[model samples]
Target: MGDGKSSPNPSSDGEEEVRREMPAKKKVVVVMGATGAGKSKLAIDLASYLPCPIEIVNADSMQVYQGLDVLTNKVPLSERQGVPHHLLGTVAASEEFTSKDFRDLAIAIIDDILARDRVPVIVGGTNYYIQALVSPFLVDDVVDDITACSLNSSRELKSVDSCAGYERLKEIDPVAANRIHPNDHRKINRYLSLYESSGVPPSSLFQGEAAKKWGRADCLRYDCCFIWVDAALPVLDRFVDQRVDCMIAGGLLNEVHEIYKPNADYTRGLRQAIGVREFEEFFRYYFSNTMADGTCVCGNCSAYNSEDGTPSSINEYEEALEPNFLEILNSNDNNLKVLLCESIDKLKANTRKLVRRQKRRLNQLKKYFGWDLHNVDATEALLSMPCCLL
Candidate 1:
């Protein structure tokens, strides 16, 4: 929509008139990059440079949930500098927030901001969310009755094994089947459902020229200015390590403990966050070995409350547990210590992996979708600026 080329005029005399008459597309700035690359900071900083008021719409999948402020690295209100942020920590921790949901809400919020004469800055490392916001089509959107179709497909395939499902998908839509892993039963089932419901092969949806450039600039919903806040891998890796340590010290354990449950589902919602599942083994062992009757078994532990069995406050409860927690951490039991240390190391390692993955996906988007990303190097800032700012 913002291709920067003027429309051809029928006559030379009417060229100026046609140029003046054409309406300008609304501008939306999208700041994206790897995690810990300072996308949020850059989005906030754009407020001072852009002439109009700016509101940020978070596109990060994890940061959209209600908890794990430290784990998700959500910018604190004090650091937001009074800039309004939408869809940040607005979803229930247990609820699944999908790309469709994000696109629907972000479009509404962006429209509202544009109507108010303020620019909407989309910021996050989740490129899929940004892609959904800008692009009109989604793979799932092709089905008119996806829920009903999925139910019927599930019933029909209830008795089928994974191997059988793959064979069936290959028979009906070999192109789609070849694209995905044989182990990806969810995607296989989805393809089966789409074909069964619409009487069309799933592969047909992606066959046309229009589908080839699904998320390219020519097919965008808004005139988007994409900014990639980038940094050297070494710098990002070191920063991520320090950031994980800072998150741990900033009560990450307490947060994880609050949400920890035995045999909890870590495949969905906030539980899918990097820090949450990484400590599952540690917490399972910690609670079983150290906790008894809602109090630590360690002699150094104090009663949560003498008057009532319950804690006075959440803060006081956490404070009482902290010392006992530390004692267990320092305990002679090598197993517990190993689990705790391994979880921390895993958190850092996973975060670094996420950084690399996000960077790769960003490049893929630029290469495949023709995203004109303005790269802003942040290595200097990462070195000099406080980790909290990033």
Candidate 2:
């Protein structure tokens, strides 16, 4: 469905002046929480009662993938309670989604709503994503080869080469060691790499830029509303149990079994969603074992098991436009394309501004953008973003 909104009416002081037209104002409400956090249920509830027509903006990392809704724990339309929603199940499972893409899409849809005058209610708790939707990327830590080697191999750290790197890191960026998990050889190696190459500690580089970047809202030049959902731990845990049960009921086991293969790329985009990975492991190594010996422990299985996610994959890619712009650019109808392109560009830009505005409030809390947060850049070498963002 689309945004249903009316144009805004802005009045100016009477000075015998000609009246300029007013534009529709965009407003958003975001529902955030971890899995099983009742985000969808709450969003639909708000949409039903609010004076403004409510549209849901999906912030879940996995639900954007077209057909994998079952394992991702997506709320069905029957479950949406008649509110018009956008951007859920919009992308094909085979495609890659970046937070940048989601940020752009959310902006566009919100603009469409504002043009008509409706409220956009963003839902779901892809935590980092909730931040990224509102803020720019920050690079904090230095990642290097030694960290990679150490994290990869569970080898002795006192080895001469590893110790040398450790000492070097201690001297240049001691705080980095303090911050990262001591057992996390990957991070240690990265800090050492930064120390080796830059001769400066990772801590020094991202101090301001590292975090606390969200300044005051309203002050940032926008009229907006922010709502945060804090579900209790016990309640959230129960919700998770129910959600996992639902996934199993929805054929998540078969889904995992289908993807369980040596040739299968479990690391592929939507396939790496949380439950997908767990069950994939359950199937490949654990399933046959369950049938053969009936247990989860495999002392002899190969060591590809990792709890880290398919962050790179589990996002919505850019959606295609009406193609009129391309046709115009091709001189096949140039005038129409230019007009549409300009219009779409403005909408997307305004949406991005609003998203950035929202990120500031969420960032200030520090729970969502906590010191415990990990930087995406340090994890990967590419220009990429989380689906929601932190």
Candidate 3:
């Protein structure tokens, strides 16, 4: 929805003048938490009662891509009410929208909101995008391998000898090598390239740039208020289960089929969404195991293929199959039930993992910008006005 411009009335000339002279503080509200933690709902609720108009800027990476609204857990139109939302489902599913892209777009949108005298509410679970917007992406943070190379083409950077490269980096840029895990060949390559292109080490570049910028490595690029909406793990787990069930009922599998293609670009873009990849295996198995009319052809029908095409014969995948896997597959109703249950469990597990990672990111954010953070229990916050100051 487009933002509604508030026109001034001559009758309220005094109030308008005061507002124009002393505009509201230009700060953005960042509601961050795990999936199914009700971050979006909290933003809508807060905006509903705020004295000033508020606009929601989407920060969830998946929601930016067009389609898969149900899978991405986008707020339904009926629920959004009349509040204007920006950056949700604005990009095509085929395209990739990175955190850098989000940072640029969001900054511009936030500026417009401030110009319109409306508060910008940034809400989502994608911690990286929010982090990018809040902090500056220093040039030293990203070491270009090509720029690091002295020659026209450095084949060593692209060599399969990853171990030798790690050793080489340790000899040249010991600080960079120590910061990077020995097993991480990609980072090793980047450090090696930086050394080859320039005699200086990555540590020196970072320290030099950091000293020039804010006397430290990290600095806030935007003044923001971080609201961490948190809930108990058990409560969140139940919510995750219910959300997965709802997505299934909402035809999430059909939505998956719409964009599901063999050898598709699953590593990038909307296809990387958890639901899309997790369900791809089940959908493929379901289609192949069943007939054109949905008749079961396999006896137990318990065996299923994973994303890697490895067959698992039980509720969980194991190197050794159960002795009665064949017998179980032959079972009538129980076989189908088990397969469906396993698929659902996989979805729940993946979602839970995502939430755990997001929660951990909170600690990092708190450490980086602790003074700016104000966390609240989501359940308690929902009952009362979370941000009365806004």
Candidate 4:
């Protein structure tokens, strides 16, 4: 998230005025894909071909939080090309934002856009947020209590033993525990909330008819069409690799350090975003020369060095990190390079996992909510989705 209030494209004011004069289309087009697959570009380009003026509604959960702009991959305002965008970098990073919160706010935003007679194009990689908007699967009837439980859990989890909450979740909902990673605090908290609010575990609830029942007919709020920006796995892998390199080059570490609050648990709020947690080890290395969580391993070696700044090259990193290399019997420049390379490799690995999860969710959309997705090859330039889709 960034510091200031979110801005609309200043160049689009005149066109937006004209758009307000037209009749409401009351229609929606949703763009979904893995990160770095050009979902934002597709949304911006798709707006141009639509007969009615289309305003973008962001569905990406990370981008909704303010600051960490580069890590979140916020579409540069210049790239917006005079199209109005909503909900980009609107929440502070310290705040807790959830899919249900997005769904309610998006509903109101869509209504406002419809009243102004403009089209709303929903774009983001967060399929969960999109699902909340298009389906009643997470209706307020259920979410209100869940939200209360979440607040209670947030408070309770902090004071009690950390593992206690996770253990309780496993004891009550082992099926959910099996599905969720032990380290994933967000899912643990959510599963616990579900148990607390509903007095039923997710495994049984998921198997119930109510959870299984969802369709287009249930979406009485607005008509929806989903466009999936598709790319081959090899192509996506290349894109992800290039994107990871760019993010690191663009000072993603600095950004992470700036917003990172120590002791911030991933189970609550925006800290769970990939870069913030992934760079924990790197940040420790940067701030404290010793790799051992601020503990100096060497008894006689000086722990502090003037070369504590961000290293531009492997040589610089090697020189700055020498003190921390005392543990290695025959530490050399090559050894330090290998350690640094491991950090980058870890970042790339985490990013690939995120991309795979996103694609898996996209594949399961139809199965979960009966959403028929139109596929678009994003690598092709000058491509346009069929505007006739409603």
Q: Which residue pairs show backbone clashes in model 3?
A: 148-197, 299-329, 299-330, 300-329, 300-330
TM-scores of all predicted structures: 0.79, 0.52, 0.67, 0.71
Which portions of model 3 show Cα errors greater than 4 Å? Answer: 1-25, 138-208, 211-218, 290-337, 379-390
lDDT of 3 by residue, 1-390 (tens): 237755456468677687699645457788998887788877988876778899999999889989998888788777786778999999998775666678889999999998999989999988767866776653334555335445633545554465687778878778666444344444566566666666558666556555345212235665577888888787777677777877776667557756766456565578878877676565555545542333334323234453433344333322222222233334674645477567668889989988888887777667644535677776543333322111
Q: Provide the clashing-pair count of each candidate structure.
A: 0, 18, 5, 5
lDDT of each: 0.80, 0.49, 0.67, 0.67
How many steric overlaps does candidate 4 have? 5
Query: lDDT score, residue 317, model 1?
Result: 37
Kindly report the root-mean-square deviation of model 2 from the true structure over all alpha carbons: 20.7
Error of 3 at 390 (Å): 21
Q: How many Å off is the CA of 123 in candidate 4?
A: 0.4
List model 1 lDDT by residue over 1-390, tens digit each: 578766576486487687689777679999999999889988999999999999999999889999989889899999999999999999999897777789999999999999999999999988778888998776557544454545454444444566688899999888767544454455566677666655678777666864865687877888999999999999999999988888877778778887887787665688878899889899877655544345564454463554444545655434654434445567887887889899999999988998887888788789877899999999999999878778
1-390, model 4: which lDDT tens digit per residue? Answer: 568755578658777887799564357899999877788888898867999898999998889988888788888787788888898999877777777689889999998997898989999988767877876666333534555656453443335344687788778878666444444455566666666655667666445554665334344245677899877776666667777677766666557656554455655556767767766665555444443333333333233332543334434323332233323324443543455567667877887887788888787776655677898876543133321110
The lDDT of model 4 is 0.67
Per-residue error at 247 for model 4, in Å? 1.5
Pitting candidate 1 against candidate 2, the one with the higher TM-score is 1
The segments of candidate 2 whose C-alpha lies over 4 angstroms from its true place after superposition are: 1-26, 136-224, 263-268, 285-390
